[model samples]
Target: MIGSGPALAADGASTETAPAEDVTIVVTGEKQDRTLQQTPSSVAVATGRTIVDQNLISVYDVLDRMANVVVNGNRTSFSIRGIDASNVLGGGDGALASVYLDGAVLPKAALVTGPLDLTDIAQVEVFRGPQSTVQGRNALAGAVIIRTADPSYDWSGRARLLLADKTGERRASAAIGGPIVDGQIAFRLAGEIARSDGLVRNVNAGGDADRRKSETLRGKLLFTPAAVPGLRVVATYMHDRHRRGGLYVELQPPYAPEDRVSTSDLIDVTEVKSDIATLDIGYDLGSGLTLKAVGNYSHIRSHYAYDPDHSADPGQIAVIDDPNKTYQQELRLNVDWNWLQGLIGAYYLRDDNRGYFFGATQNLSLRRLGVDQSLLKLGLPQATVDTVINLYGSGVPIVNSLDQPRVTQNHAAFADFTVPITTRLRLRAGLRYDRESQRRGIDQRVAIDKPLPDPAAYPGLGPIIGQINGLLQATAAAATSYQPERTVRYHAWLPKIGLSYDVMRDMTLSLTARRGYRAGGSGLNQQRGQVFVFNPEFTWNYELALRSAWFDRRLTFNANLYRIDWKDQQVSVQLTPGSAFDKQVINAGRSRLYGLEAEFSARPTATISLGWGAGYSRTKFTDFDVGIGQVLQSAAGNEFPNAPRWTLFGSVTWQHPSGLFANINARYRSAFYQSALVQTHRDIRPLTLANAKLGWQGEHLGAFLIVSNIFNVEKPVTSALDPDGRLRGMVSEPRVMGLSFEGRF
Candidate 1:
């Protein structure tokens, strides 16, 4: 939580002491919207100016610099304190981290992959901790709250373009904001377009089919009038479109990178439209009491169409359709109730998602490649049909070729109150009662009267299908013998509590414990042929934090140590080979996540500004004894996959305070893993990349040159098929260097 007072950027290990500076930033976690320096939690803020300087276009860039967070840009994988292994499905990723754009949630795990354009953003706030108490569900790790530029009765806008050299990727952006009606209403509109010639060339296909193209549009409207002094209405929407090269498994024996080919099986497509409308009503009813009411409604829908990265024949391709949707509404009213200040709020959310995956529905003849004649002439057996179905079901990941839709709903009402125990100590308490439910189901598909094309002429088909079913049926988990739809549901209630105190003249201490639950649903594999249902999981999070500033406010620091005991932990284990989705949810036992984080910002000199933040986390299975036994006992000593043991982000800004001609700024991040498998540790390691910018600014115009990955380093996150190391993922986005320009009158 942010502290409860004015905040000034502090020094390095020591606070900086120049003249007093007045800058107020909204803190996280803490009840009061205090300055960043006063926030009790380890929070980081990326100002709009900073974002512009670095060309930080998406959430990926934001997470990379957050404390203790590990991000793999390939598939847009991320984790904080090594507690993220979120499946790409609709439900939560269990990532322990959440993303909020203008206070609206980003679509599910899949929606966040590609690129996010940063055109008219106001500020980005990150809170690293169990955000359940304030953020609600899907906040197991922490929360990312992005606020875009709201409309202003005052007109404003910007148009910028960039030409890049990373395979010739070109980017252009524009935005406009101002009054829709003078002093009555305001609006802000922004859009971005970018395209690239990929690095890989499928020469056989004629061009680098691995190209990327994206376009984004966003708009906001604000309604406020002198007639309604303390009332304002805000509405916003964002639409994003993207097309990139799909995954192609480099076909090899047992499937390894040695036989790697930049396959183009899937064409990842996404269209996300978010709608948010909020009415903020504030009134002074006399008696030193201020009354306020805030209501919000939000909705999101996204779909993806692409191929798998792990196909036996890297040449094999499939067209898949995955769509996910969510709707949420919130209402809150707080008042200055004399000695006690409090707010009570209620929330409701609905999830409706559907996906259908079927391959070779549009098949091409590959029989001539490695044809087998002798065996085909002999006519092997009846089991051949079953084998083909089995292989067809499991062969392609991500494109599970099944229809499974998961629906979930949540209703909760929460309230927080603060009382002045003394001028030095303020007692705080928050309580929430939530009801969550999740339901999952699947549908199976069939081949159209598909009889073999005279196996006698195709002997190769015999072992192929036979081998397929043989490997698939190996697990009792899926009865490929039967084709039916299955459904499962889960329900739960969660609560939270906390305490805070101002211990000294410039220090504050706090402690909090909370419980968070994610409604469980059925698995996508249920569409494979059988029914498998699992229960929901919950977490009990406990934490302690300290915020302090000394040396006449020159030095400021905050640190937190936390422990979370999670029960019924959800684990995504694939039962079949080559599949990228989780097969089922098991009642995995308890686990613990503990970590420490700190941040320091200061103006070392009248002309220089610096900031540093870092975090270390150790997450492990403490007592994960499944019904069968301990699956993680042997893996106990090993660090959790995807969780980086250490993460660091730092920045330095050299400004002329005197309004000089030249100013430069820079930022960087250390390395982290990209996968959950300990054996593939080498695949994703430490990455050290930097960005620098030189610019000149004045009232009428501004210009700057931003250079990213200044060293032109190739820190490829190794995945052969998709961006994420799921199934057979591949690596993309080599060193991207571009020049950007902007000006205003």
Candidate 2:
């Protein structure tokens, strides 16, 4: 047995058969039900059973198993085939990739402060290339689709309890579903709660520096009325709360320490709460035509407080509050005929993001602003300049109590069609017209909290006291209290074309070309208190794919080769020398990326299975000019940040007739750079991790022992230098051994 059994196909259909190799998997990520071999795109699919069998606890865990995909150490962002989810620019209003839960698109913040735990998921699909024609705006790089289990008409329930060592992690989850009105209505409920003491120790605070706690609850209702022949309705509601401490640990002398520890006096923390609701309705009309409508709404709030200086001294503490809301609606008509299969859809979305910030100033920030240089130019002596800089370090206060809100609205119409030209050949095409508009504003106040020293006390400073006071006032006035609201609009026409050829009964070859784009928007320059707009970036992707099965359908192989040309890329550029706040997003970069991915699965025997996947990607900047202080430098041949050149994953599983099983899986990633700047590029070092599980299965209950990072490999996932000249970074989680009990009723 694999996982709980064979496995449920992507469309919620059971694929259990006499031989696991004979199971046919269906994919629904393209809005159409088709066998994996019949789909013309590059996609990675994992069923709920697979997730459970592999002990994949989070979204990142699942992504790590896929080819050409990488998740940053912090788990806040991911990259697909060399393109990051949050675009390469790193300072933009739109994302390059999108994440969908059920039928609703998640907000960007959700990806950062995630409800990432996999508790009651049904299936997960990762599309490697652009899905712009079908997903609109944010599908320039790729997309992730997650579907939770639907309510079934059978009375069934499942529960799991987990306990782990190292982090002292504990979790409990349960899901139940049954018929409420026999064959007419059904309801399902699921809930999970988890807590962990975290790994990094906070020496100054006397606790874990990165503790975590989370809770999730979800309910779904399904209705299929007998009065209306072919009508199905589903309503879902979900609530989630997650909290975590800081993410970094300080490094001792040589900038490398064997233990995870932090010296901050304050316990940095972030908490997020979210509520989501969705309704989906589908009606079948005569003549093989169907209509569907979906509506979704979500509200989220996040609170974050951290010590920026990360020092024992009470220098600066930062606090931020963000509240967001989104509403989305979509309607589509599906046509399924003998000669043609397609869908036409229209979508609308409105998102409102409101946030406020409050904090004290850090001396390092002033250094970045060149305050000392300004004092020197004002005829102040070096000693006096140093004294003034020290005085202003912790004496400045900044507050943005008023919401700096950004509201965005999107409207799109799209259509995708597949037409059979011959029995073995098919032509597929798609187009999408999208329009996006945004309104944004900023309100901030900066003040001096402590008194400045009298210039009269200094020997030669008395003559320039007025100038020094004027400079101080100007520094405090850099950020304005009010700024006029600005509105910007963007439009894009995305198109895709592909051809799929059935070379043999068990083989398929496909070639495709598609256009993908990220919408343009306005951004605020925090230092100058000014707003600026950037143009949308675009990419043209060409791909070739192959899918084949062999040896009595006992082995499967799939491969994809793709090339992407990117232009008008949005990148952050500094307008002046030595000022971080003077940076703004501009359309002044170009890049090219190419990659290949191959995966294979073999089931030589009824009780044994093996799987492997590998990916190779090459990324380089074709034309890029960035302002480093006052000089504009070119980074023509530099690789994109966080883009690894090679990725490999493999897994093996064995099961016996007596209900005993064992599984082992491992993943490897090559070294990559963490910054795009050629001068500052630092290799993040490669990593390899392995996991194992041993278990016994029965009819209604199962128990398993699992160990992650079995090698106890401890390495830095991310690293950076702090203002105090000490190296700090986040390290990989320590090895953990756990036991789980699963029961079904």
Candidate 3:
């Protein structure tokens, strides 16, 4: 029932039962389950009824219809094909694209926003480029798998409801499964709740500055036991909660440009909580062998605030208090003998991140001491010098704090194999050997003295209050204090290779190569108050793929071509552009990327169906020159910040058997640049989006009428510039109209 849109079940969420037709579109990117023409990388799969007919709720709406994904901030960071995985506001040591659900692994503050709920989801893979031989070191910019919906040997259920208009949204969901002991026990349950009224517009906090709420709960259990012989067990649990309202916009040249509004004098918020647990076990060592084990745990907590100087001034604001924890384990073995097929694994990870950053401190020395043009040369106007500097800078207490604790540890070993040289030639290989360690700690502080400002209530200003308290005590005596600690040890040895032939009867042809890495830590730049140690960064990928079919199968095609070579890349340099944690995390940079991907599907009759996907990339920058605040320029050739060189998506479906149905989807993108310095007014402009659904189906009831951004494109999914150069952004999601309902039992 992968619902909301890709034509597969039209809304029936059918995998054609029977062991879900042996794993529907399979290809879990080599962690077995093969189809999609026997997997050889470059993957993408979305089901759950194409995420409920493409109304996908987050994970950046499934990376905007996959195909060389990109999900920049608005859902925090993501990239693949421009290879991203870090820097959604710097500080990293892991994650270069890695997210898994059924196989656990998630918790980098739950990857910044999303309750990861697609009601009873079952399938969503996207593995493109280096996964480091089965996901090591966070896959180096590739990997996203999520699977759910297991546990049924009979009875089942479903329920859903949704409503939307512009930004007013409400949603509800439910799922259930059964066979408590019918096939040796099984159970499943799911829940969801969503709310929204967001899309910024805060005109001084008089309401809605990006509002939202989310909730989810899930449970699952499956066991096969009759006094255990071939053993099996699976268990899972999840919980999530989110509350939002922040990052509002407005600044397009001091408002007006059709001002979307935002001038928060207070109201800023963001909260999140998450918990996850998993356990899976299996055994059957008979002849063909098999054994597996998995265990995972995750916890996350976050609180965020904003308005840092996008002010109407309740005096600056800016907070973040994150807490995270993660643990994982894995052990696997599988074999099938006879012409071979294999797997072996071992993995472990531990992650813990503790964070802090508090703020309020941005008077920017009244435009660097010009003090409202010295109060209009003392005759005071300009609204009495802004009401005496907002009545003494909103009761000045100025503070900026930071505390961070990070920890990571990993150990890995992996292996993969598949062979058969005869029947149309085949071969595959894999390897992984990772060792990691990272530990960091830092605490920084700044506090602007206290209680002072009674020169008998400004009777002649006392030399402008002693020159603004001596420029706030020399900017809090040169701010940022640090107590650094470090530990870094990284080891790598990733490898993968592939080959395939049989290029005729329905075709197949392949070639692959990979190696990717990211590891190097120890930070705390605070504008070069120093404590840096950076290194690791690598990539090397080469791919070629084509999988074809035609006519008899009602057409299908796939294509991939790739190249990448990046090395040493780290880059997050911006020292002191008006304080507040002035950045630094360098490794310089070097890059190169090449890409092309394609896919097409067709059915042509029996009620029509079609699909298409496309991508093209060319991320430049080969060698960069850092230093931003005070210029050092030279960002090679730029273009690799939200990397977009082209992406297109398409879909169409129609069904009628007296139950009428229709679906259409479209997307296109091609303009990029949001950072890595190259302000052509911050670029980010290409856009096109379309979505539709029309329905009426019954067997167990269903109804739909969704339309999203059918044409109202506002683009700019995020942009920045403040530090007083003002020029804010955050747009997208302009038109929406929805109504959906479904029921089954």
Candidate 4:
């Protein structure tokens, strides 16, 4: 949590110089608006001012520097501590960690891409533990809450432009907000456009890979009529369009050097368009009571295509077209009194998602390559090779297609209360009941355009021709009208209990225990045509925390120690090796995780501020076994995937009275495995990054320059290994320097 104080120039980490006795940081997700010091949990905050100064483009940028948080591969996967929001079995109805935008819960697909621009953002809050009681389902791990800037009565607006080297990236944004009726209503409008040529090169296509362009538009209105006292309504609408080049998978061979600038015959591509609308209403019912309601609707359409072979030859290619729709609503009431405060709420969500995939047969046709090097190596004459090629027409390219449609519904009711047990002690408790139902359907088909000739017509080459044609027919035959649909129902009760005590004049101690749950789902085992249903999983989390301020409110320090025991973990099992559709989801045994985190900010002098934070986590699988009849493999003692052993981050800022400031930040993460197999070769290497910024500000204008990745480290962010030992994955960003200017009126 950010301390209550006058902080240095905002640039990522919190760099506070002197704590202000009157200053307070408010947290809204805790049922009642309370100061960070009053909340008995771990949370991280990044303000709009910090976002602009740090040049943060998305939520991923802000979460990367946070303690005990991991943002993996293409910013699509996120985890807290060692637990990923996306369950291992991939059978959950929703994400374990929920992302809320302006009180509206966003779907998992929206979370994977990015959030709206920060031009209209007020603050970003990250809760670092299970918040099932108040947050409801899918919050077993944690949650990210974002609030947009409110409309102000004063007419004001700002515009900014940015240019960067390395990727030839450019961005422009503008925003304006004012009053529609001096004291009754207000409105805000904002938009941004960003484009990047990208750093990775595709020599084969004579173009850059991963190039991207995006545009966004948003509008908000706040209405507070004088005729209806204590009543307010807020409405928001947003549209976003994004397009990107293919993934740059740099293949590594024993004979070649590392290639960050290369790819094969196919250039992958993707495009997405989304529309979102939300409304929030609140009314003060008087007598320390309030009523609130929130509703949201979203629609998204996306397309993706990529080469599966990753080579110069057109061996295999795949593409997907997906369209999704989601609707959510929540209603709640809060009561606050001298001795007691609490909240009760109910939530509803419905999601409709559909996808279509198309691909060719497994291996490229060899029937057309009768005269290749293999035949030449056999000392066959060129004439004979040509004759053989003429005997067999080009091999058929079987086209296969699959269509999947799914729907899920979630309903939950929850309540939380806090009571003062003594002058210096308090007790808190919460309960939640959730029910989920889901159904999915799949349809597949295969086709080919070629057929074999009669054996009597080509007796001499009948044997070879028969073999090739038979394989093609078999491939087409494998596609069947198999429709597997099942409806799964789940219900669970989640609870939380905690204690808080004010032990000293400026210090507090707290202890909390919470239970988390993720609902189960049904799927078909494609290998054996068998249907299966995996059971839900649960986790118990315990934490002890200390928060304090020192030196006449000039410094602050905080620490947290936590442990979690997970039971009935969902695990994915493969029926056979190298079979894409042959997998099943099942419930495995237990796992354990424990960690410690410490954070501090101090001002040794009035001109300089320093802040540092570190965290260490240990995770292990206590029991795990797999196989049909006997245990073929066990991962009982393996570390969790993508979970680093420890993480360290710090920031320093220097400011001058003349409005000049400079800041620097550094982060380090230890090595960790990328998969549950625990193979040494699959471990991701450790990394350390450094960033710096120099800027100056006036009353209504500001300018700055930033240099990121000073060392120009070309590290691999994620990796994929082929059966033949070829390794390739997405690489980290190279060095980049940017200059920006901003003006307000």
Candidate with top lDDT is 2
| lDDT of every predicted structure (CA atoms) | 0.55, 0.80, 0.72, 0.72
Q: What lDDT tens digits, residue by residue, belong to model 4 across residues 281-345?
A: 88999998999898999887777777665555455567877777889998989889889888889
Query: Which of 2 and 3 is the better model by lDDT?
Result: 2
Q: Candidate 3 — worst ten consecutive residues by lDDT sum?
A: 1-10
The TM-score measured for candidate 2 stands at 0.94
Q: Lowest summed lDDT over 10 consecutive residues: which window, candidate 1? A: 10-19
Residue 452 CA displacement from its true place in model 3, Å: 14
C-alpha lDDT (0 to 100) for residue 383 of candidate 2: 89
lDDT value for candidate 2? 0.80
lDDT winner between candidates 2 and 4: 2
* Model 1, runs deviating above 4 Å: 1-20, 28-32, 85-96, 113-115, 180-182, 247-261, 265-301, 310-315, 354-400, 446-493, 524-528, 550-555, 574-582, 629-633, 657-683, 720-733
TM-score, model 1 to reference = 0.80
lDDT of 3 by residue, 446-467 (tens): 6764665665677776666666
Residue 420 displacement in candidate 1 (angstroms)? 2.7
